[model samples]
Target: MEIDKVKDPATVKLHSQVEMGSMELKSILGYDDQGLVAAPEKKSSDEAPLKVLYSSGSGSFNRKVMRNTVVHSIRTVVFSSRLNLLMPFGPLAILVQTLTGHHGWVFLLSLLGIIPLAERLGYATEQLACYTGPTVGGLLNATFGNATELIISIYALRNGMIRVVQQSLLGSILSNMLLVLGCAFFAGGLVFSKRPQVFNKPTAAVNSGLLLMAVMGLLLPALLHTTHTELHFGKSALALSRFTSCIMLVAYASYLFFQLKSQRSLYVPVDEGEEIHSDASDDDEEVPEISKWESIIWLTILTAWISILSEYLVNAIEGASVALNIPVAFISVILLPIVGNAAEHAGAVMFAMKDKLDITLGVAIGSSTQISMFGIPFCVMVGWIMGVPMDLNFQLFETATLFITVLVVAFMLQEGTSNYFKGIMLILCYIIVAASFFVHIDPTAIQDKPPETKE
Candidate 1:
């Protein structure tokens, strides 16, 4: 005891506890001292300083990521094309609307503004599609590609511009089937002058059949009205139109399921000649410029802006018709569709030039099918909910135009081959349609006038 230095039991216990605590702390801090004489450890660096540095670095990192996202989204969407030059027209249109009563100028400016926006909208959708995979991607393209027209239709519907909605939707189908597809075929043929361009025949046939079905959906209503053979007079025609719309919507849903799920192979892009290697290489090289979330944000912003401009555009239609000395029929049936479809038109032609005829057909014929099968019926349902009397009765002239157009397109696509001659014919057919609309007066316009009293 005298040699070892005896201690009190309580003091020894406390000392042991302190040593145990020190060892645990050292272990947690990754320190070790063994098999040597231990030197006094320098004071551990202050955790406060390290923590402050880490926090600041993390904050800066977050900021950098956010900045990159913004820059990338802007560069991809706003600066991707020369079409962006038209973007200023959006703000200018608003200014013109606010400052003056020049509805024609406002309409023109709004039309120009929407061109870039529509193209960018499609671009954003395509970027998003890269994330969604091909099946959902095709649906996204169809939906957003028609978004401009849909927005305009909604605005028109809200204003009780029923005829405008009908004609505009009809025009969208016509423009896609004729003008966009024609340009695509024409451009592709010129580029591949030595051979004919080919697309997926089954896909084209399916789209053609769907277009014909849509024609029937529209035709029956017009015929019912014109023949005065409705079971309940005026009320019966409206009822039939609503019922038919619901059925058409169901058919479109099934078609989408077929294309996306059951028979997806039918829609795969058909590459021929030298396109196979080039397309494969291009697919490998293709990378999305914007992230998925960024694509979504841009789509929302673009759609909202489109809705705003579409409001202005719809409001200006009647005024612009009077001020510009253009017939309302031509404006609704020809001009509006062309402007709304600028994105689809450009994309179809570009793909065709690359000899990707399958994609071209999807952009053109698929769009026509969507408008007829989905867009028109969806509009009818929307109107029903809104207590608006939107219907499939496109009048005799419009319905007949649609019917013949479908037949012509169906016949042309039956061969599953396209050449510049076929393209020229389609283009000529569209020109004739445009000319007819230019001179044609809307029956609804005349009907809206007060009947004259006998002098």
Candidate 2:
């Protein structure tokens, strides 16, 4: 078919627009003829109908494209919107458990309910970041990224659940390093096929070093605690822990300065194929920013809900543990961490599936690093303030587990490339750690000891 014979109103208008020197319309239509003469006609008999329709600027083509876009957007929302829709379950779980006094039911519902609520917190913080500019946005994201774990730990610590808090911290580190990272790699591998997912190797190396340092910071205190059990009032242990917390907090602050000010590029992930050129004139159109007030509102609502759900979760722990036949160590180390970081885990996996390995690594590995550097120490300090004795004195097994997890993860991420097998290996390591915690029952350990023996 010829352009003149096409007999479409939009196409005719498009042609007229092109004649009137509309470069945008011409570029969109891919129109060219002998160095800008008459528009080209269909040159191939095998041309697809939709392509031809689109090229002809037909109304059907616009409708079809609009329909496809709308459908895709709806699908994305439906899949992701499930979490927002289930937000009420957090409060409902609290209410039901309060009314019926069924700890098991309350625990289950709250656990399930908090997943979406936590995810929404991330969404809210991210939205808030868009308005706060990079520096403040980064701060907001950093502060609230682990709010779930912080809130849960604070509540547990207040309730005299020190063991639960300790185990949950350990679980959070292991889960992020092994389970979350592995899932990201596996999903990315499947998405990209045989090609290895690439990321900023130098940045990963620096993060690995920081993570190792954090693990050591945690390990040394635990080692000291193991050696000196006869100290009067355990004051020696508390002093050392407080000192380490102060040092760790200082280190965390320096890290913030480094990431946000001194060496920012070392922290930001730049994809291999991304264009580096910038158009200064188009700054406003380039970035998608949101409203600060709206983000704050969401943050408030979600945080309040998370607080309610966490309360229910904390209250039901003892009963849920006995009813489920799961040890406190397992619940704290495995279940709590998983639930706390559910939003991050989902985000990492989603990014991996999209082949955005750099972002995936940041979400998974960077988060684990934050947990080690910030969340754990924040809790320790909070416990100190409340006169609750929280320390980094993890059990021997936990120390060993953390050591191995950090070491193995560091090795795997050294190359800044990932595959399905690597992901599987990480997952297997996490499962092994989890199984060990489940089977290894310590009767004398305060944290492992339950209030009531199961019948």
Candidate 3:
């Protein structure tokens, strides 16, 4: 029994293991030559507890996979960028909550708007990368791009946030022309030392449509300001907005029809240099059918989340505006919209760096298309359901600025290839618009129509 007790587990396992003599064992055990000794056993309190890092007991393996994946560095950059872009929306909800009491929850409903928008943009981005003409598919993407911003405007309209709606509209148009396009042009110029090319005939048609719509965006307000007749449409009457936008809508639709009909010959031929040559010997086959369904499911799920998040963002934005005392209009129009388009902005910058000129151009121009085609219509329809009409008209000062920006962008995009000089001109055009807005030109002066514009 004395020998067996001494031969038990090592006293200090971490240190070197040693074979001890009987004398040492006797000393440690406090036993000698066939004598019994009472020895104290180690207590649980004296030992270090075991540490466990991973356990499968809590939840799904998929979540664990995601958690492990997040540790990689590259995904970290993209994720951080996306999150930074999304932060403004959370504050937006607080702003809404501040503006209204519990009624603010209704605004949360607008998140449903995020899905169609993302789907449209993702599709457009992919299509444009292939040097494809701005097809119906591409146009659909353009529509979605403006989705969240448009939805927020509708929600604000439902709440009778006239000032917010108009301001956000102003913000979207001006930001695209100035901040969005300006940033794109400037960055592309600096990074690649390349220029913005005009898209001649077909691209020109699209530019013309854009410029016309922008002008209409301004004219709606000017016409309303002067006529003072609130145009209504039955229970769902066409407001002054719809009538003015109708002209623009007709013009764009016609332009689209003409371009698509002649697309093969007119738009820079799609298959020129972009055709990829794949080797027959390569083992990678066309993707399996499961991949398609997976993409669709992911797309649907992501869209749903975006809409939910957008609703949260709109409310937070309203709350933040009240808290900050900054013009909610400015925040909605400029800051918030930018947050929503952070993905496109990143896409634009990446394409510029790689010098993918046509896709870069499409990203810039297509963004505006998304805002005009998708954003405006969505706002109008949603606003109506809520019983508050969204007006697209502008005062003379704003109208004039929009008119000028239109001419500049159109002229720049008239031919297909681009370089930095044209990009500078575009930036310069944006600067004039910014200055005019900053100065808050009197409505009277702009209405007076300086002799030059009148002639």
Candidate 4:
């Protein structure tokens, strides 16, 4: 009887089992899928060995697939080289959460998964940059790469986790300036230990100035609220925060204008020695060039998935925090920023590996600048619109940390030279900040009204 005509459940089951068994046998015998079906009917014992394509068309196609398989296999062997191999673990984490209602494990796995996804987002932005010029590319990467932090903060704000939102924002700044930049410098030093890594001094100076401007912007409100004690203090502080946010938005626009137009030359790389290669392509791998539209599509898809994962990650926050007995403020300030800016960490490291201090510096400084100039202000506006009304009056410790970070990084990069010890010193500063937060962060310091829920 023809298998196609078989309608009996027993017969269908038998056939399916037989087919699966045959496929399994072909797999055990070491034959390709195409050979499985074709071998029985057409392949002869004497037939010419399946010629591996070494040319264009079918041969090239087969070779490409073979090469990719071999490369991936090798990458698995070299764990440090192919961190993106962990990309598969992302979906696996989602599955784990779905199968077992364990928010703790889900949070852990999701955190692990987010690291590679964020890195890929940065990679996608780089591929997108090949098609779009520096201006658009920088904008795209900044908005999308930082999307993780922004989305996570928004979710936190909606849940009335105002402390997390504020802490995470400030933490991201420190992570970028201190942690990420520190790692970059360290990596650069490793590669070019004999010589100092030099980048565009002028560009670094401008970024430093802008970061200082943002630091001052944050400082004013903290100072005002601290110095003045009144019955309407909360209202005054809120009003001052909103006004500062508006001014920041304007300042951000001017920064963009400066980067894109008036001071664009400072950013343009002249030679390999002087140029900071914007992650146009992965130096270690043959990353396929993607179209602009496809890049956007993937960017959107990745950003959406990141949002979902972030929710799960954040949902488990309380559980994890309680289980670990860590302060919520510490998690928000240290761990959350690390999770959110995982891409920057990896990107900065990648450039540092290539000894491109300029790009490494750019990624670190650029990210902090964006968060200060754009992200904070945007979140403040969103909070107000949602009736949550987040303010910029960060804890004195947080404000002081920002000041120190900006001061130290600015001084370090002022001469456009970097060394291993410098990187170590910067990292030590971050470590000190993290340790302090772990010991003293008070989640209850900021009193925020709960976000209203719909009936």
By TM-score, the best candidate is 1
C-alpha TM-scores of all predictions: 0.82, 0.75, 0.59, 0.75
Q: For model 2, what is the error of residue 227's alpha carbon versus the real structure, in angstroms, after optimal superposition?
A: 2.9
List the lowest-lDDT window of 10 residues for candidate 2.
Answer: 281-290
Q: lDDT by residue for model 2 over 405-430, one digit each (tens)?
A: 98999899888788899999999998
The lDDT per prediction is 0.82, 0.73, 0.52, 0.76
Top candidate on lDDT is: 1
Clash totals in order: 0, 0, 36, 0
* TM-score, structure 2 vs. true: 0.75
**Model 3 ranges with Cα > 4 A deviation:** 1-124, 127-137, 194-201, 227-240, 259-264, 269-299, 424-455
Candidate 1 structure quality by residue, lDDT tens digits, 158-275: 8788998999999999999999888888888898888898877999899989888998998898899899998988887788889999999999999989988898787886656445
The residue-by-residue lDDT of candidate 4 on 1-455, one tens digit each, is 56657667777798999999987987766566765555643454423344422332466678787798656533432243366666666687688778986766877888887877787776666667657644455566667768888888888899898878888889899998898888878888888887787777887888889888888878888887888863487787888889989998998898888878887877874255534445444443324355566667667877887777887888777766655666777777899889888777876777677655565666778889899988998999999999996988886778888998899999998887788889999999999999988887464644211111111
lDDT of 1: 0.82
- Worst 10-residue lDDT window, candidate 4: 446-455
> Relative to the unseen true structure, what is the C-alpha lDDT of residue 50 in candidate 1, on a scale of 0 to 100?
62
1 or 3, greater by TM-score: 1
lDDT of 3 at 438: 41
